[model samples]
Target chain A: MAQNPNRPISPHLQIYRWGPHMAVSIFHRATGFVMATAGMLTLLWWLASIAGGPESYATFQSYVVSGGEEATGMQVAINWFFRLLALGVTYSFFQHMFSGIRHLLMDLGAGYELKTVRTWSIAVYIAALTATALVAMLVAARFMGA
Target chain B: MGNGTKLGRVRGLGSAKHGGKHWLDQRLTAVGNLLLTTWLVLSLLWLPNFDYETVAAWLAQPSVAVPMILMLANIFWHVRLGLQVLIEDYVHDEGNKFATLTLLNFYVIGGAAFGIFMVAKHAFTGAPA
Candidate 1:
Protein backbone atom coordinates (compact mmCIF):
# COMPACT_ATOMS: atom_id res chain seq x y z
CA MET A 1 0.00 0.00 0.00
CA ALA A 2 2.98 2.25 -0.23
CA GLN A 3 3.53 4.59 -3.13
CA ASN A 4 6.49 5.73 -1.06
CA PRO A 5 7.70 3.74 1.95
CA ASN A 6 10.37 6.33 2.54
CA ARG A 7 9.27 7.16 6.04
CA PRO A 8 12.20 8.16 8.21
CA ILE A 9 12.93 6.03 11.18
CA SER A 10 14.77 7.29 14.24
CA PRO A 11 18.04 9.16 13.80
CA HIS A 12 21.23 7.20 13.51
CA LEU A 13 23.21 6.50 16.68
CA GLN A 14 26.01 8.96 15.94
CA ILE A 15 23.69 11.96 15.43
CA TYR A 16 21.22 11.22 18.17
CA ARG A 17 21.76 12.76 21.57
CA TRP A 18 21.93 9.90 24.01
CA GLY A 19 20.44 9.54 27.48
CA PRO A 20 19.95 6.77 30.01
CA HIS A 21 16.41 6.36 28.74
CA MET A 22 17.72 5.93 25.23
CA ALA A 23 20.36 3.51 26.47
CA VAL A 24 17.70 1.58 28.36
CA SER A 25 15.59 1.36 25.23
CA ILE A 26 18.51 0.03 23.20
CA PHE A 27 19.69 -2.30 25.95
CA HIS A 28 16.25 -3.78 26.35
CA ARG A 29 16.35 -5.10 22.83
CA ALA A 30 20.08 -5.83 22.78
CA THR A 31 19.90 -7.85 25.97
CA GLY A 32 16.84 -9.68 24.82
CA PHE A 33 18.55 -10.67 21.60
CA VAL A 34 21.68 -11.76 23.43
CA MET A 35 19.70 -13.94 25.78
CA ALA A 36 17.68 -15.30 22.94
CA THR A 37 20.71 -16.39 20.98
CA ALA A 38 23.87 -16.90 23.01
CA GLY A 39 22.27 -17.30 26.40
CA MET A 40 19.69 -19.74 25.19
CA LEU A 41 22.27 -21.76 23.28
CA THR A 42 24.54 -21.98 26.30
CA LEU A 43 21.70 -22.93 28.60
CA LEU A 44 20.60 -25.71 26.27
CA TRP A 45 24.14 -26.89 25.80
CA TRP A 46 24.72 -26.85 29.54
CA LEU A 47 21.66 -28.98 30.11
CA ALA A 48 22.54 -31.40 27.39
CA SER A 49 26.10 -31.70 28.61
CA ILE A 50 24.90 -32.62 32.07
CA ALA A 51 22.37 -35.01 30.75
CA GLY A 52 25.18 -36.81 28.93
CA GLY A 53 26.62 -37.54 32.37
CA PRO A 54 29.88 -36.67 34.16
CA GLU A 55 32.12 -37.51 31.21
CA SER A 56 30.74 -34.69 29.11
CA TYR A 57 30.03 -32.42 32.07
CA ALA A 58 33.72 -32.62 32.96
CA THR A 59 34.57 -31.18 29.57
CA PHE A 60 32.03 -28.39 30.18
CA GLN A 61 33.48 -27.62 33.58
CA SER A 62 37.02 -27.54 32.35
CA TYR A 63 36.19 -25.20 29.54
CA VAL A 64 33.41 -23.16 31.13
CA VAL A 65 34.36 -23.14 34.78
CA SER A 66 38.11 -23.57 34.99
CA GLY A 67 40.58 -22.41 32.45
CA GLY A 68 42.42 -25.60 33.07
CA GLU A 69 46.11 -25.58 33.89
CA GLU A 70 46.91 -27.68 30.85
CA ALA A 71 45.32 -25.15 28.55
CA THR A 72 47.85 -23.02 26.71
CA GLY A 73 47.80 -19.96 24.44
CA MET A 74 44.42 -19.54 22.74
CA GLN A 75 42.84 -22.41 24.62
CA VAL A 76 42.97 -20.70 28.02
CA ALA A 77 41.91 -17.41 26.48
CA ILE A 78 38.88 -18.89 24.77
CA ASN A 79 37.88 -20.66 27.95
CA TRP A 80 38.15 -17.45 29.92
CA PHE A 81 36.23 -15.60 27.25
CA PHE A 82 33.31 -17.98 27.48
CA ARG A 83 33.46 -17.61 31.26
CA LEU A 84 33.28 -13.83 30.86
CA LEU A 85 30.44 -14.18 28.38
CA ALA A 86 28.50 -16.20 30.93
CA LEU A 87 28.74 -13.25 33.31
CA GLY A 88 27.76 -10.92 30.50
CA VAL A 89 24.70 -13.08 29.85
CA THR A 90 23.83 -12.87 33.55
CA TYR A 91 24.10 -9.08 33.38
CA SER A 92 21.93 -9.08 30.27
CA PHE A 93 19.24 -10.95 32.15
CA PHE A 94 19.10 -8.35 34.93
CA GLN A 95 19.33 -5.37 32.57
CA HIS A 96 16.48 -6.68 30.45
CA MET A 97 14.42 -7.81 33.45
CA PHE A 98 14.61 -4.48 35.28
CA SER A 99 13.94 -2.51 32.12
CA GLY A 100 10.95 -4.76 31.49
CA ILE A 101 9.71 -3.90 34.98
CA ARG A 102 10.01 -0.22 34.19
CA HIS A 103 8.05 -0.71 30.99
CA LEU A 104 5.44 -2.76 32.85
CA LEU A 105 4.88 0.14 35.23
CA MET A 106 4.48 2.46 32.26
CA ASP A 107 1.94 0.03 30.81
CA LEU A 108 -0.06 0.25 34.03
CA GLY A 109 -0.29 4.07 33.65
CA ALA A 110 2.36 4.94 36.19
CA GLY A 111 5.81 6.61 36.14
CA TYR A 112 5.04 8.69 33.10
CA GLU A 113 6.57 11.87 34.44
CA LEU A 114 9.67 13.06 32.64
CA LYS A 115 11.69 13.16 35.85
CA THR A 116 10.49 9.72 36.94
CA VAL A 117 11.31 8.32 33.52
CA ARG A 118 14.87 9.61 33.65
CA THR A 119 15.31 8.37 37.21
CA TRP A 120 14.22 4.84 36.38
CA SER A 121 16.27 4.66 33.18
CA ILE A 122 19.41 5.37 35.21
CA ALA A 123 18.27 3.19 38.12
CA VAL A 124 17.98 0.15 35.87
CA TYR A 125 21.75 0.18 35.37
CA ILE A 126 22.48 0.42 39.08
CA ALA A 127 19.93 -2.23 39.98
CA ALA A 128 21.07 -4.71 37.37
CA LEU A 129 24.74 -4.36 38.31
CA THR A 130 23.85 -4.73 41.99
CA ALA A 131 21.83 -7.85 41.35
CA THR A 132 24.57 -9.42 39.25
CA ALA A 133 27.06 -8.61 41.98
CA LEU A 134 24.80 -10.24 44.55
CA VAL A 135 24.62 -13.37 42.46
CA ALA A 136 28.39 -13.44 42.21
CA MET A 137 28.63 -13.05 45.98
CA LEU A 138 26.21 -15.86 46.63
CA VAL A 139 28.08 -18.15 44.27
CA ALA A 140 31.35 -17.21 45.93
CA ALA A 141 29.89 -17.85 49.37
CA ARG A 142 28.64 -21.24 48.35
CA PHE A 143 32.02 -22.21 46.89
CA MET A 144 33.64 -21.12 50.14
CA GLY A 145 31.27 -23.34 52.12
CA ALA A 146 29.80 -20.34 53.96
CA MET B 1 -8.92 21.42 6.43
CA GLY B 2 -9.48 18.64 3.90
CA ASN B 3 -11.88 15.92 4.92
CA GLY B 4 -15.02 14.64 3.18
CA THR B 5 -15.90 12.61 6.26
CA LYS B 6 -13.95 11.83 9.45
CA LEU B 7 -13.71 8.22 8.35
CA GLY B 8 -12.44 9.27 4.91
CA ARG B 9 -9.29 10.93 6.27
CA VAL B 10 -8.56 8.00 8.63
CA ARG B 11 -9.26 5.19 6.19
CA GLY B 12 -5.90 3.35 6.20
CA LEU B 13 -4.00 5.06 8.92
CA GLY B 14 -2.75 2.71 11.56
CA SER B 15 -0.45 -0.31 11.51
CA ALA B 16 -3.37 -1.48 9.33
CA LYS B 17 -2.90 -4.95 10.64
CA HIS B 18 -3.33 -6.86 13.85
CA GLY B 19 -3.80 -4.35 16.61
CA GLY B 20 -2.12 -4.79 19.99
CA LYS B 21 -2.11 -8.53 20.48
CA HIS B 22 1.64 -8.65 19.84
CA TRP B 23 2.10 -5.85 22.35
CA LEU B 24 -0.07 -7.58 24.94
CA ASP B 25 1.66 -10.92 24.47
CA GLN B 26 5.03 -9.24 25.02
CA ARG B 27 3.89 -7.73 28.31
CA LEU B 28 2.19 -10.88 29.57
CA THR B 29 5.25 -12.98 28.78
CA ALA B 30 7.43 -10.33 30.42
CA VAL B 31 5.59 -10.82 33.70
CA GLY B 32 5.90 -14.59 33.43
CA ASN B 33 9.63 -14.37 32.71
CA LEU B 34 10.12 -12.05 35.66
CA LEU B 35 8.70 -14.60 38.06
CA LEU B 36 10.16 -17.74 36.49
CA THR B 37 13.69 -16.49 35.83
CA THR B 38 13.89 -15.30 39.41
CA TRP B 39 12.98 -18.78 40.59
CA LEU B 40 15.59 -20.22 38.22
CA VAL B 41 18.34 -17.95 39.53
CA LEU B 42 17.49 -18.76 43.11
CA SER B 43 17.33 -22.47 42.50
CA LEU B 44 20.69 -22.32 40.73
CA LEU B 45 22.22 -20.30 43.55
CA TRP B 46 21.04 -22.80 46.15
CA LEU B 47 22.97 -25.60 44.50
CA PRO B 48 26.39 -26.32 46.02
CA ASN B 49 28.18 -27.15 42.80
CA PHE B 50 27.75 -27.26 39.04
CA ASP B 51 28.86 -30.88 38.80
CA TYR B 52 26.68 -33.24 36.80
CA GLU B 53 25.83 -35.29 39.86
CA THR B 54 24.98 -32.44 42.20
CA VAL B 55 23.10 -30.27 39.73
CA ALA B 56 21.44 -33.26 38.07
CA ALA B 57 20.28 -34.54 41.42
CA TRP B 58 18.87 -31.13 42.24
CA LEU B 59 16.97 -30.97 38.97
CA ALA B 60 15.70 -34.51 39.54
CA GLN B 61 13.60 -33.30 42.44
CA PRO B 62 9.93 -33.11 41.47
CA SER B 63 9.61 -29.66 43.09
CA VAL B 64 12.55 -28.35 41.11
CA ALA B 65 11.77 -30.12 37.84
CA VAL B 66 8.20 -28.79 37.54
CA PRO B 67 9.12 -25.13 37.88
CA MET B 68 12.20 -25.68 35.80
CA ILE B 69 10.03 -26.92 32.96
CA LEU B 70 7.64 -24.01 33.34
CA MET B 71 10.47 -21.51 33.53
CA LEU B 72 12.13 -22.91 30.42
CA ALA B 73 8.84 -22.75 28.51
CA ASN B 74 8.02 -19.22 29.63
CA ILE B 75 11.48 -17.88 28.91
CA PHE B 76 11.53 -19.37 25.41
CA TRP B 77 8.09 -17.98 24.63
CA HIS B 78 9.12 -14.54 25.78
CA VAL B 79 12.31 -14.69 23.78
CA ARG B 80 10.42 -15.75 20.69
CA LEU B 81 8.02 -12.82 21.02
CA GLY B 82 10.84 -10.35 21.54
CA LEU B 83 12.76 -11.70 18.57
CA GLN B 84 9.68 -11.43 16.36
CA VAL B 85 9.37 -7.73 17.15
CA LEU B 86 13.08 -7.26 16.61
CA ILE B 87 13.15 -9.05 13.27
CA GLU B 88 10.06 -7.22 12.08
CA ASP B 89 11.40 -3.79 12.93
CA TYR B 90 14.85 -4.25 11.53
CA VAL B 91 14.57 -6.66 8.64
CA HIS B 92 12.79 -4.73 5.90
CA ASP B 93 13.16 -7.04 2.92
CA GLU B 94 10.08 -9.20 2.56
CA GLY B 95 11.74 -12.44 1.50
CA ASN B 96 14.64 -12.15 3.89
CA LYS B 97 12.39 -11.20 6.77
CA PHE B 98 10.04 -14.03 6.04
CA ALA B 99 12.89 -16.51 5.99
CA THR B 100 14.36 -15.06 9.20
CA LEU B 101 11.03 -15.09 10.98
CA THR B 102 10.39 -18.65 9.89
CA LEU B 103 13.78 -19.69 11.22
CA LEU B 104 12.94 -17.95 14.47
CA ASN B 105 9.70 -19.87 14.87
CA PHE B 106 11.45 -23.18 14.38
CA TYR B 107 14.36 -22.22 16.62
CA VAL B 108 12.20 -21.19 19.54
CA ILE B 109 9.86 -24.13 19.25
CA GLY B 110 12.68 -26.62 18.91
CA GLY B 111 14.56 -25.04 21.80
CA ALA B 112 11.53 -25.13 24.05
CA ALA B 113 10.59 -28.65 23.10
CA PHE B 114 14.16 -29.83 23.64
CA GLY B 115 14.38 -28.06 26.99
CA ILE B 116 11.06 -29.43 28.15
CA PHE B 117 12.10 -32.92 27.11
CA MET B 118 15.41 -32.53 28.93
CA VAL B 119 13.62 -31.47 32.10
CA ALA B 120 11.27 -34.41 31.82
CA LYS B 121 14.23 -36.68 31.24
CA HIS B 122 15.97 -35.39 34.34
CA ALA B 123 12.81 -35.70 36.37
CA PHE B 124 12.38 -39.32 35.53
CA THR B 125 16.00 -40.38 35.64
CA GLY B 126 18.18 -39.48 38.58
CA ALA B 127 21.95 -39.09 38.26
CA PRO B 128 24.08 -42.23 38.33
CA ALA B 129 25.04 -43.87 41.63
Candidate 2:
Protein backbone atom coordinates (compact mmCIF):
# COMPACT_ATOMS: atom_id res chain seq x y z
CA MET A 1 0.00 0.00 0.00
CA ALA A 2 1.19 3.48 -0.86
CA GLN A 3 2.08 5.58 2.16
CA ASN A 4 -0.31 8.47 2.63
CA PRO A 5 1.23 11.75 1.50
CA ASN A 6 -1.08 13.73 3.73
CA ARG A 7 0.77 12.43 6.83
CA PRO A 8 3.31 14.81 8.29
CA ILE A 9 6.80 13.42 7.80
CA SER A 10 8.98 12.86 10.82
CA PRO A 11 12.26 11.09 11.36
CA HIS A 12 11.86 7.49 12.53
CA LEU A 13 13.93 6.03 15.39
CA GLN A 14 16.41 4.27 13.11
CA ILE A 15 17.17 7.46 11.23
CA TYR A 16 18.66 9.45 14.13
CA ARG A 17 20.78 8.90 17.19
CA TRP A 18 18.69 8.48 20.33
CA GLY A 19 18.37 11.61 22.46
CA PRO A 20 16.68 12.63 25.70
CA HIS A 21 13.32 13.58 24.22
CA MET A 22 13.31 10.33 22.25
CA ALA A 23 14.32 8.41 25.34
CA VAL A 24 11.62 10.07 27.35
CA SER A 25 8.95 9.39 24.76
CA ILE A 26 10.02 5.80 24.06
CA PHE A 27 10.37 5.03 27.75
CA HIS A 28 6.92 6.36 28.39
CA ARG A 29 5.45 3.92 25.87
CA ALA A 30 7.75 1.16 27.08
CA THR A 31 6.67 1.63 30.66
CA GLY A 32 3.07 2.05 29.69
CA PHE A 33 3.14 -1.27 27.84
CA VAL A 34 5.01 -2.97 30.66
CA MET A 35 2.62 -1.76 33.34
CA ALA A 36 -0.35 -2.64 31.21
CA THR A 37 0.95 -6.20 30.93
CA ALA A 38 1.78 -6.18 34.62
CA GLY A 39 -1.79 -5.10 35.32
CA MET A 40 -3.04 -8.12 33.40
CA LEU A 41 -0.62 -10.38 35.25
CA THR A 42 -1.90 -9.01 38.53
CA LEU A 43 -5.49 -9.68 37.52
CA LEU A 44 -4.60 -13.22 36.51
CA TRP A 45 -2.93 -13.78 39.83
CA TRP A 46 -6.09 -12.61 41.59
CA LEU A 47 -8.23 -14.89 39.46
CA ALA A 48 -5.96 -17.84 40.11
CA SER A 49 -6.08 -17.16 43.79
CA ILE A 50 -9.83 -17.18 43.67
CA ALA A 51 -9.95 -20.43 41.71
CA GLY A 52 -7.23 -22.59 43.26
CA GLY A 53 -6.95 -24.64 46.45
CA PRO A 54 -4.05 -24.65 48.92
CA GLU A 55 -1.62 -26.56 46.76
CA SER A 56 -2.28 -24.38 43.76
CA TYR A 57 -2.15 -21.26 45.85
CA ALA A 58 1.18 -22.33 47.27
CA THR A 59 2.40 -22.89 43.75
CA PHE A 60 1.39 -19.38 42.81
CA GLN A 61 2.99 -17.85 45.87
CA SER A 62 6.09 -19.81 45.05
CA TYR A 63 6.10 -18.08 41.69
CA VAL A 64 5.93 -14.70 43.42
CA VAL A 65 8.47 -15.19 46.19
CA SER A 66 10.88 -17.51 44.48
CA GLY A 67 13.59 -14.90 45.10
CA GLY A 68 15.45 -16.93 47.74
CA GLU A 69 14.51 -20.44 46.74
CA GLU A 70 17.15 -22.91 45.61
CA ALA A 71 15.66 -24.46 42.52
CA THR A 72 12.81 -21.94 42.16
CA GLY A 73 10.97 -24.35 39.90
CA MET A 74 12.28 -24.95 36.35
CA GLN A 75 15.92 -23.86 36.55
CA VAL A 76 15.28 -20.15 37.21
CA ALA A 77 15.37 -18.58 40.65
CA ILE A 78 12.14 -16.80 41.53
CA ASN A 79 14.13 -14.10 43.23
CA TRP A 80 15.96 -13.31 40.04
CA PHE A 81 12.77 -13.30 38.05
CA PHE A 82 11.19 -10.94 40.50
CA ARG A 83 14.30 -8.80 40.60
CA LEU A 84 14.37 -8.36 36.84
CA LEU A 85 10.66 -7.73 36.65
CA ALA A 86 10.86 -5.27 39.48
CA LEU A 87 13.81 -3.49 37.90
CA GLY A 88 12.00 -3.05 34.60
CA VAL A 89 8.79 -2.01 36.27
CA THR A 90 10.55 0.31 38.66
CA TYR A 91 12.67 1.86 35.96
CA SER A 92 9.62 2.36 33.80
CA PHE A 93 7.70 3.87 36.66
CA PHE A 94 10.37 6.42 37.47
CA GLN A 95 11.13 7.27 33.87
CA HIS A 96 7.46 7.80 33.21
CA MET A 97 7.17 9.97 36.29
CA PHE A 98 10.13 12.07 35.25
CA SER A 99 8.84 12.47 31.73
CA GLY A 100 5.43 13.23 33.13
CA ILE A 101 6.80 16.03 35.25
CA ARG A 102 8.51 17.38 32.20
CA HIS A 103 5.25 17.22 30.27
CA LEU A 104 3.49 18.95 33.14
CA LEU A 105 6.03 21.74 33.01
CA MET A 106 5.46 22.06 29.29
CA ASP A 107 1.73 22.30 29.85
CA LEU A 108 2.42 25.21 32.16
CA GLY A 109 4.43 26.72 29.27
CA ALA A 110 7.64 26.74 31.23
CA GLY A 111 10.95 25.20 30.17
CA TYR A 112 10.49 26.34 26.56
CA GLU A 113 14.06 27.48 26.07
CA LEU A 114 16.58 25.07 24.51
CA LYS A 115 18.84 25.30 27.54
CA THR A 116 15.92 24.62 29.86
CA VAL A 117 14.78 21.58 27.83
CA ARG A 118 18.29 20.14 27.86
CA THR A 119 18.63 20.72 31.58
CA TRP A 120 15.24 19.17 32.30
CA SER A 121 16.08 16.20 30.09
CA ILE A 122 19.24 15.54 32.08
CA ALA A 123 17.30 16.00 35.28
CA VAL A 124 14.78 13.46 34.08
CA TYR A 125 17.48 10.83 33.64
CA ILE A 126 19.04 11.59 37.00
CA ALA A 127 15.70 11.55 38.81
CA ALA A 128 14.63 8.34 37.14
CA LEU A 129 17.81 6.54 38.19
CA THR A 130 17.58 7.89 41.71
CA ALA A 131 14.00 6.78 42.03
CA THR A 132 14.91 3.38 40.64
CA ALA A 133 17.62 2.96 43.24
CA LEU A 134 15.31 4.04 46.01
CA VAL A 135 12.68 1.54 44.90
CA ALA A 136 15.18 -1.28 44.62
CA MET A 137 16.61 -0.55 48.02
CA LEU A 138 13.15 -0.47 49.58
CA VAL A 139 12.22 -3.77 47.99
CA ALA A 140 15.47 -5.33 49.13
CA ALA A 141 15.01 -4.08 52.65
CA ARG A 142 11.45 -5.33 52.84
CA PHE A 143 12.30 -8.81 51.58
CA MET A 144 15.46 -9.00 53.65
CA GLY A 145 13.73 -7.93 56.82
CA ALA A 146 11.05 -10.53 56.24
CA MET B 1 1.65 49.71 32.19
CA GLY B 2 0.48 50.43 28.67
CA ASN B 3 -3.15 49.55 27.63
CA GLY B 4 -1.69 46.28 26.37
CA THR B 5 -0.07 46.00 29.83
CA LYS B 6 -3.39 46.91 31.50
CA LEU B 7 -5.28 44.20 29.59
CA GLY B 8 -2.52 41.75 30.40
CA ARG B 9 -2.67 42.90 34.04
CA VAL B 10 -6.44 42.31 34.17
CA ARG B 11 -5.97 38.82 32.71
CA GLY B 12 -3.83 37.70 35.64
CA LEU B 13 -6.29 35.19 37.13
CA GLY B 14 -5.13 32.41 39.42
CA SER B 15 -4.84 29.78 36.67
CA ALA B 16 -5.07 29.52 32.89
CA LYS B 17 -8.53 27.95 33.32
CA HIS B 18 -9.26 24.20 32.73
CA GLY B 19 -5.58 23.42 33.26
CA GLY B 20 -5.99 23.25 37.02
CA LYS B 21 -8.94 20.95 36.66
CA HIS B 22 -6.93 18.45 34.62
CA TRP B 23 -4.02 18.75 37.02
CA LEU B 24 -6.32 18.16 39.97
CA ASP B 25 -7.90 15.09 38.40
CA GLN B 26 -4.49 13.58 37.68
CA ARG B 27 -3.36 14.17 41.22
CA LEU B 28 -6.56 12.72 42.71
CA THR B 29 -6.31 9.62 40.58
CA ALA B 30 -2.67 9.25 41.59
CA VAL B 31 -3.66 9.49 45.22
CA GLY B 32 -6.31 6.88 44.61
CA ASN B 33 -3.65 4.62 43.13
CA LEU B 34 -1.51 5.10 46.21
CA LEU B 35 -4.30 4.18 48.61
CA LEU B 36 -5.60 1.29 46.53
CA THR B 37 -2.09 -0.04 46.03
CA THR B 38 -1.50 0.03 49.75
CA TRP B 39 -4.63 -2.03 50.27
CA LEU B 40 -3.55 -4.47 47.57
CA VAL B 41 -0.13 -4.82 49.15
CA LEU B 42 -1.58 -5.51 52.55
CA SER B 43 -4.09 -7.97 51.14
CA LEU B 44 -1.41 -9.79 49.19
CA LEU B 45 0.73 -10.04 52.29
CA TRP B 46 -2.13 -11.63 54.18
CA LEU B 47 -3.16 -13.90 51.32
CA PRO B 48 -0.42 -16.53 51.24
CA ASN B 49 -2.12 -19.07 53.43
CA PHE B 50 -5.66 -18.52 52.19
CA ASP B 51 -7.39 -21.34 50.40
CA TYR B 52 -9.72 -20.82 47.45
CA GLU B 53 -12.77 -20.83 49.68
CA THR B 54 -11.27 -18.46 52.20
CA VAL B 55 -10.19 -16.07 49.54
CA ALA B 56 -13.63 -16.17 47.96
CA ALA B 57 -15.27 -15.46 51.27
CA TRP B 58 -12.99 -12.48 51.84
CA LEU B 59 -13.68 -11.08 48.41
CA ALA B 60 -17.40 -11.64 48.78
CA GLN B 61 -17.60 -8.99 51.46
CA PRO B 62 -18.53 -5.46 50.38
CA SER B 63 -15.39 -4.16 52.02
CA VAL B 64 -13.07 -6.02 49.69
CA ALA B 65 -15.43 -6.16 46.72
CA VAL B 66 -16.42 -2.52 46.42
CA PRO B 67 -12.96 -1.01 46.90
CA MET B 68 -11.52 -3.39 44.36
CA ILE B 69 -14.25 -2.59 41.83
CA LEU B 70 -13.64 1.10 42.32
CA MET B 71 -9.91 0.68 42.02
CA LEU B 72 -10.23 -1.32 38.86
CA ALA B 73 -12.46 1.28 37.23
CA ASN B 74 -10.29 4.20 38.27
CA ILE B 75 -7.04 2.56 37.21
CA PHE B 76 -8.35 1.89 33.72
CA TRP B 77 -9.90 5.32 33.44
CA HIS B 78 -6.67 6.98 34.47
CA VAL B 79 -4.78 4.88 31.98
CA ARG B 80 -7.22 5.88 29.27
CA LEU B 81 -6.65 9.55 29.96
CA GLY B 82 -2.89 9.15 29.97
CA LEU B 83 -2.82 7.21 26.71
CA GLN B 84 -5.24 9.67 25.16
CA VAL B 85 -2.71 12.45 25.62
CA LEU B 86 0.12 10.29 24.33
CA ILE B 87 -1.78 9.37 21.18
CA GLU B 88 -2.85 12.94 20.64
CA ASP B 89 0.75 14.06 20.76
CA TYR B 90 2.33 11.34 18.66
CA VAL B 91 -0.36 10.33 16.24
CA HIS B 92 -0.29 13.27 13.83
CA ASP B 93 -3.14 12.25 11.58
CA GLU B 94 -6.41 13.77 12.76
CA GLY B 95 -8.42 10.73 11.73
CA ASN B 96 -5.93 8.43 13.43
CA LYS B 97 -6.00 10.41 16.65
CA PHE B 98 -9.78 10.34 16.76
CA ALA B 99 -9.87 6.64 16.05
CA THR B 100 -7.28 5.90 18.69
CA LEU B 101 -9.10 7.94 21.32
CA THR B 102 -12.40 6.25 20.46
CA LEU B 103 -10.78 2.81 20.59
CA LEU B 104 -9.08 3.64 23.86
CA ASN B 105 -12.33 4.79 25.45
CA PHE B 106 -14.05 1.57 24.46
CA TYR B 107 -11.13 -0.45 25.75
CA VAL B 108 -11.18 1.23 29.11
CA ILE B 109 -14.96 1.04 29.47
CA GLY B 110 -15.11 -2.52 28.22
CA GLY B 111 -12.31 -3.62 30.52
CA ALA B 112 -14.07 -2.04 33.47
CA ALA B 113 -17.32 -3.74 32.59
CA PHE B 114 -15.67 -7.11 32.15
CA GLY B 115 -13.80 -6.72 35.40
CA ILE B 116 -16.95 -5.75 37.29
CA PHE B 117 -18.86 -8.62 35.73
CA MET B 118 -16.26 -11.14 36.82
CA VAL B 119 -16.01 -9.69 40.32
CA ALA B 120 -19.79 -9.72 40.73
CA LYS B 121 -20.06 -13.26 39.48
CA HIS B 122 -17.44 -14.46 41.91
CA ALA B 123 -18.86 -12.38 44.73
CA PHE B 124 -22.44 -13.62 44.42
CA THR B 125 -22.09 -17.13 43.01
CA GLY B 126 -21.30 -18.76 46.39
CA ALA B 127 -19.40 -21.57 44.70
CA PRO B 128 -19.11 -24.63 46.92
CA ALA B 129 -15.76 -25.42 48.35
Cα lDDT tens digits for candidate 1, B13-104: 76666648878888888888888888888888777677677887887788888887887888888888889888988887888889999999
TM-score of 2: 0.60
Q: Write the per-residue lDDT of candidate 2 for residues A4-121, one digit (tens) a residue.
A: 6876667867887887766777777778767655754556565555645446656665665452346535535664676587688778767766687687678778988888887888
TM-score of each candidate structure, all chains considered together: 0.88, 0.60
* Model 2 docking category: incorrect
Q: Which stretches of candidate 1 lie over 4 Å from their true place?
A: A1-7, A144-146, B1-10, B13-17
Span of 10 residues, lowest total lDDT, candidate 2 chain B: B1-10
Task: Write down the C-alpha DockQ for each prediction.
Answer: 0.55, 0.14
Ten-residue stretch with the least lDDT total in model 2 chain A: A67-76
Runs in model 2 deviating more than 4 A are A1-8, A43-56, A67-79, B1-68, B81-129
